[model samples]
Target chain A: MRSVLCYGYGNPGRQDDGLGVALVEQLETWAMAEKIPGLTFDSNYQLNAEDALAIAGHDLVIFADATGEGADAFAFRRLVPHATIAFSTHAMAPESVLALCAELYGKQPPTWLLTIRGSAWEPNGALPAAAQANLAAAVVFLKEWLRRPPAAV
Target chain B: MNPEAEKVFNAGAARANAAYAGQRRNVTINPITRLEGHGKIDIFLDGKGDVERAYLQVPELRGFEVFSLGRPAEDMPQITSRICGVCPTAHHMAATKALDSLYQVEPTSAGKKIRELVYNAFTLEDHALHVFVLGGPDFIVGPEAPPELRNIVGVIGKVGLEAGKKVISMRRRVREITSYFGGKVVHPVLGLPGGVSKALKAEDLPKFKELATAGVEFAEWTLGVFKSIVLGNPEYVKMITSDAYTHKTCYMGTVDANNNVNFYDGVTRVVDCNGKEVCKFTAKQYRDFIAEHTEPWSYMKFTFLKDRGWNGFAEGPESSIYSVGPLARLNAADGMATPKAQAAYEEFYNTLGGKPVHHTLANHWARVIEMIYAAERIEQLVNDPEITSPDVRRIPTALPTEGMGIVEAPRGTLFHHYQTDVNGLITMANMVVATGNNAARIAMSIDRAAKGLIKGGHVTEGLLNKVEMAFRAYDPCLGCATHTLPGHMPLRARIYNQSREIVQELVQD
Candidate 1:
């Protein structure tokens, strides 16, 4: 059985910043309804090095998170192993989690960083209309991708 | 919940929502912000740039008490497990034990062994994470290293990559053990009123045996790393024993009849600053000995010994401000329950000069030793003959009533109290979390360290980190400390176990 993971990271309390977390919520429902096996889903405020262990042993891992610096829709980048030890602390960058997987566990499978463009960041902000639309598009794309996670970006 | 506590939570949440702007008069470090629940360190300085006071404030807007009022008592372990990811096992176990008392039943011998095995494994995982990632930087990397280099990365840079790999491998193994026992990796769902929801099968014995043996080897390796990098260095040793990071606070923990530290179950022991036994109290009598005092400025309550009284955060034998966790556990007990930890405990006191060592930095060393014991205890529990027995639970047959449960959480003693109606619905709920127990000392340690390092009006990043080191040693869970309200983490109520009769499920939309 091929193992695949989908991790969404963001603070759900924040408005549009919760886009990634919302996607995770949607994916959780989809996973249960569809009864997907060897498919794992997780969500956290941010990624930690321990997340590397979480994503370990998976053939493919999709990292979804809110990105304010990205385009209106979303962008995907294939992640490669690199030294990100210096970029670790209270939270970690998604790339750093992959780097940790390679350095600490000896093998980091092919991974993708899916940056869902967020429109706002607020302590009590709700999901914005724009980010919601973008999330819908991203979800549609990932629904097909879950059937066959790409070999590369 | 009290109105005054509610008022405090509102006030704290308002203040915590502000930006992490370090004003000229103060500095903040190691603040957990945003969705993790806001916790910021504010160091108020005098006009001349001298330290006046330091406050570690955390926002408390979680309405757990109000929401859990009408819930079934049996589902508390599953419900409270979502409180924080840091110590879900601790909360689950505490809630499970509280159910045991409320239902007026005891777990069978196999159930007891299973609980102990899981708890020890959790201890091993939690302590390893703290010593290697959280508090490890200060000792593994040079304490005086730059702020950028003073983290787990620096520890990896100093200690070879193989050691780093072992650290991750060890933590992963223990987490797997917890997942196997608890029925889930992160949020476990296996606690029951009388016993656990599931039992360990014989097929999993070899896996656990491997995990326990490997955990022992990893713990020994961690100690060796501490010995070579921390104790082996004269400067680090001196700093650990130095007065800057030292406080003469009383100690408290749970101990067996032989006065040995026991994490699962025992009487609560309290000792003076001089290591003399003050009193030992049972779980039911915790209110008589321990009392929590509220400060209007903070949401979390400050706990102090009732006999000693609240002496305004004063540190001494005369004060009720006692410390907990590994240092306190070792100090309050005569010795460790395991051979390896016992030897380490002896060397720790011998080098530091006597019982109840006041040096707070030695908390890291004490934490590592406890990890050693936790690993060894796992080995023993796994080898127990009844570990796989089918006799694990007894159905409750008594009326629901008030009950109290206490256990040694990774940080310290965790207390849970609940009062239920005849129909087995919760009426009252209260808790004294381990981090909340260390509030007085966390404040004191941060204040004293800020005073010592922020002198001469030149506040550098190094100085701020030094202050943070003091609080990090306690391994304080600011999220849980201020977890009065789930302002950030929205909870959903689902059917935990629906085989029952008349269990209503309601949640905030």
Candidate 2:
């Protein structure tokens, strides 16, 4: 079965840190309507590389997280798996998690890390305006992504 | 069919169950959807007929304040825009507002006008999204309707093709306008300390004018649909009329010289129900007037009007103090501006007895009124000659190190305060988003709604839906409320019987 795993990873309880989680929540709803059969949807909070190993066999893994570095929330770009994850606030870095999955499972799932720009990470997750705006654009993007057929490669 | 009756039945069943004979129960809802952030609801049911304690849990790990510590001030507007999608313009604007305060330089007339126009663009988009996309689904499809149908897609099915298209088109128009100024709708990067980064030119004027006109038409149509569906409908009318819930108003918002709608800048005023101002203060004075309450169960912070201090929840028909957002702003304003909306506002006030409209359910009415106001404002703004001026931004001074900005978001008034070093890197920051202001009110409403409607037995679809709808009315953003997911989201709705015993607890897997 060809499955599409969409992980919107963020700590919404953490202000700008929640961009990833908030986006995934929106994507999950959009996927329910647009994602076809043989496709399963999953979303989780920030995870470690060990947790990433659990998703090793999924056909495609798309991860969304908030980066203080990005200037905008919907600034979508393809990042190589080699991108460093040490700066990530998550329990484990994205690169480390994917690397562990590949080393253990022989082949890691194809992935895309969509980083939404954030302003602050207050103690109680009070997201910034930029992160909030990203929610809508991210949804539209996910809808578009689901509309496309899976890559032949 | 009787939503309130379900509550009575549940209460009766609780008394029958020995386990709940004398227990104090606490129930929490992690994320209430349809807004930017997530929040929780915790109610303590005393063994008797009343609620002993109720807490609204907005469990968010504070992010905005800490993360911006080392970032430069020039990036504040763009960075702050990340706070919420529904009101990024306000965030960006407010950040600039704070920088303006820090610099002690009044924006050029052209700059202020452009900022106001930008703010209004957000108003048009945010308000429309809330009423139609977020709050619309519940009212349009009916709360008891299935989950699948409680969305914009469901709205399309009932209202037909054109209405849905209008909504999508309006959203797109707002998005286009946002992009024109800030480059994109999410986390717009246009505004800076001295002024905006982009200047409006002659070419964009016509498009702006066209969109404004289209938005006004769309708003009028949308309002009519809302009237027929929620306010005019016999079922909804009955549900709201029932004595299950009520609140009093000590409302606040920014207003213009004539005490009309002002989203960008104005004196902050708190008015009573009779259209009398309780107190008026500038945005800078907010620190003295507002008091914040934090709880362990929820991450969201609750703000209370400080003059009278914390008044325990309101009793039946007495109306307790609650505020912010469109409803609160309308209550605080002297009157609506546009003749059409003003006339509508007068009718709305007369029907509801004007000013300090305390019922949380009344937020729906308040939201509709703002949509009308935004349309009117959009028309007047686009027509203004100043909008086409090229002097949209000014070079900000690098002197001041601290500043604050405030604007009314779709949900309520949002505040952003920041301190930067001489080099412009942020040293400290504080923010009070919309949902936080409504935190106490949300819990109070939930407690009232649950107590008045759910007695704790079998969860009837109508009863459960009404309780959920009460939260939905605020367009509560659980995403903004909950910063961390507990490994996975927990879906649980539990109802206890009258004797304070557990009756039914359903968990969604």
Candidate 3:
């Protein structure tokens, strides 16, 4: 069985900041109904060091998050392990978790980061209309991508 | 929406959440600035550009009391734990203990052990994060480093990438252990009213034993790192022992039956600055001894000993100011129960001039020692013969009423109190979080450090870093209100109904 791990991270309470979480929730529904084998899903406010172990034994890992820096639509990019590790009281970057996988597990899976563009960050806020459109577009793309064969990686 | 809701929160996040809304992002709020949607640290300046007073305006999260009304009392362990992302386990354990009191049932021996095992694992994780993530930059990366360099990344750069890998890996191992027992590390769900739902099977004990053993070695290495970086350097030690970061307030924590520092359960012990025991009280008597003074500006109330009266934020015997957490636990106890931790504790006091060390920066040292104890305790727990016993819970059959539970959170002493109806429905729920307890000191620390560092309206990144370090030493955990809606309300009425009662509610400017 080819194991794939989809991990989404963001502060869902902040408007549009929950884009990553929203995406994963949609994927979970699709995966469950379709009975997509060898797929596991997890979500949190931010990626932490332990998530390295969470993804350690899996063959492929995809980290999903909402970004204030990217374009309004969405950007999906492959990620490589970095040699540095920096932590905080706030949150950890996706790349840092990937790096830990390499350092601690003596193995690194092929990984990608799906960054949904977020336009707002109000506390107890809702995802804005435009961001919701972006989320819908991204979800469509992700659904197609997941159905594709593993050779695409 | 509750009137208090309009006064503070938007509650949009709570509303947006549907089935499997996934993990919440709004749990880690600090003190909020009412209706403003964000917290601010206001520094009032005098004519000469000298600091008058600095107040960290912690906005109150409104309607939680009202939000939680009419819920089954048993749901509190799960609900209250959702308040913070960082220390959910602390809140969960406190609520569970309160449940025990409310139901008037004692957990089976195995059940209490399971809870402590998981609780100690979380303490280990929390302290490691603080030492390496929050406190590391100031000491490891150098105090005078640039703004960009004053972070865990910079600390890793100086401490060697190998150490970074070990730190990350070690933290993961401990968290995994916490999850194995508590069901999840960030927001645990295993805690129940009488006892835990799961037991430590003999088969899985080996994995936990391996990790707990690693935890001990990790502490030894971390102490060595601290010794070389902070204590070994005279300048660092001087700064740690400096007057600007010192507070001569009283200390409080829970101690075991032997009077050693016990994080899981103990009586509340309060000690003066001179290392003299002031008073020891049970969780029920917390009211007679402690009082919270609320300021219009902060959502959090400043806690002090009632006998001293609310003397404002001044730090002295006459003033009611007090501190908690690792330093407080150490000061309030006779010693640590574990041998290695006791040795470290004694060395810490001796190095800092013996008993009730006043230097706040030494909290980092005290915290490390506590982590050592937690790690050792985890090992001891894994070896217990009854650790695998199936009798993990004592089915509660007692009447419901009022109950209180206290625990030593990695940050400080955390208090959770609840009052329920005869049918076990909650009527009242109140918490004076570790951060709430330290609110006055947090403000005072900023004030004192600002007076020393920020001169004549001039402030550099380094100077501000120093001031930031003062709060960092406390390792303060603020209520992180990140959600658009109040998601903590598993069952809601007050945050909504209270707002309905308030026909005219205005957002404070």
Per-candidate total of colliding backbone pairs: 6, 71, 30
| Index of the highest-DockQ prediction | 3
Better of 1 and 3 by DockQ: 3
Give the C-alpha miss distance for residue B374 in model 1, angstroms: 0.5
Full-model lDDT, candidate 1:
0.74
lDDT of 1 by residue, B343-383 (tens): 99999999899898988889899999999999999999989
Query: TM-score for the second chain in candidate 3?
Result: 0.86
**Model 3, span B26-55: residue lDDT tens:** 222332221224344444444455544444
Residue B227 CA error for candidate 3 (Å)?
0.6
Worst 10 residues of 3 chain B by lDDT: B489-498
**lDDT tens per residue, model 2, B1-509:** 13475466445334433332233244433333222222333334545544433334434545566777888877778666655443557778888898887766678777787777777777777677667655666677777776656544465567775665567557657656767777733336677667777778988789889988887887787778878888878877666556555655467788878888688888788776555777777767778777787544445677876776654333222223556787788888978878767877887778666555666766777787787778778788889888778887777655877787888877788787888778878998888777777777776677667777755333565665676667767765444322222222233455444344445554421
lDDT of 1 at A144: 83
What is residue A101's positional error in candidate 3, in angstroms? 6.7
**Model 2: DockQ score:** 0.06
Off by over 4 Å in 2: A1-153, B1-55, B295-297, B314-320, B456-458, B479-491, B496-502, B507-509
Candidate 2 to truth, TM: 0.72
TM-score of each: 0.82, 0.72, 0.82
Ranking by TM-score: 1, 3, 2
